[model samples]
Target: MLTLPNILTLSRIVTVPLLAALLWWPGWATGYLLGFVVYSLMGVTDYFDGYLARAQGAVSRLGIFLDPIADKIMVAAVILILCAAGNDRFPPLIAEVHVIAAMIILLREITVSGLREFLAGLQVSMPVSQLAKWKTTLQIVALGTLILAGGFREQVWMHDLGLATLWASAILTLVTGWDYLRVGLKHMD
Candidate 1:
């Protein structure tokens, strides 16, 4: 139950509040820089946790359950933080039309989670699609780059690039999310 991979996953869950604290003050560029480093480390650990689990044949039910939960928690936290206002240099990522994008991602996550739970209860497995993986990758890059943009306030380009990625991810989110829903609906009744 307490394998190294699980420990790493648990560490990410444990440290999210600290991550939120770092982002609490938007004016704190130093804090944002540190948050970026911490966020990057969390991403690295996310990779290794699964890699080590598979390589060592240490995968467990606990690991399978916690991994996605940790990921969602981290992503949600960062999104909510970035959506709030504070720094003049770094505006809210979810401002104006971006709110629709952000809401799309959030809504998809909730919908898919509920669908997964329903399928699980029916003893049906809904394997992740390849495009879903791409959506996850785009989302991580979008959020990470946005956080990094906060650290580099002078680099408006970073913010713009981050916004670009955010919209791209949102587009992917809609596609993958609808795919999941289509499959899920088939098993509904």
Candidate 2:
């Protein structure tokens, strides 16, 4: 339960508040720079936790259950913080379209999480699709890029690139979420 891998996972959950604090203020270049570093470290821990769990063959029930929850919590927090910061600073840049894209991704995460819980209750395990994995990969990259861009806003192109990646990620998220829901629905009836 308190294995090294689990400890790494727990660290991510604990550090999210500090991450949020760093992203609280818009145009706080230094804050965003620190946030980017912390965020990247969190992402690294995310990878190592799973890798260590598998390598050590210490995959506990708690680790299995808490891993995805930790991921969702982190992703959701980042989205909310980015959206809030964007709104406060670059209102036009994070306007309706951008907000909707973020909302769509958030909604999909919640919906899929609920569906996964339901499927678990039904004793049906749903493996992640390749596309879903790709989506997650892209989503992480997109968010990381955006956070870095926030820290380096003097370079307008960086922000533009981040926003573009974000939209692309949102599109993939919708597709993958729908795929997961479709699979889950088949088991429901």
Query: Predicted candidate 2: what Cα RMSD to the true structure?
Result: 1.6
Model 1's TM-score against the true structure: 0.96
| Residue 113 alpha-carbon offset, candidate 1, angstroms | 0.5
Worst 10 residues of 1 by lDDT: 85-94
RMSD of each: 1.3, 1.6
Q: Which stretches of candidate 1 lie over 4 Å from their true place?
A: 87-90
TM-score per candidate: 0.96, 0.94
lDDT of 1 by residue, 112-172 (tens): 9999999999998998899998998999999899888888878989988988999999999
**Index of the highest-lDDT prediction:** 1
For model 2, what is the error of residue 153's alpha carbon versus the real structure, in angstroms, after optimal superposition?
1.0
Cα lDDT of model 2 by residue, 1-189, tens digit: 799999999999999999999988877889989999999999999999999999999999989988888888888998898887654445423455788877887899899989999999999998888988787777788788888887887788887787788788889999999888889989976
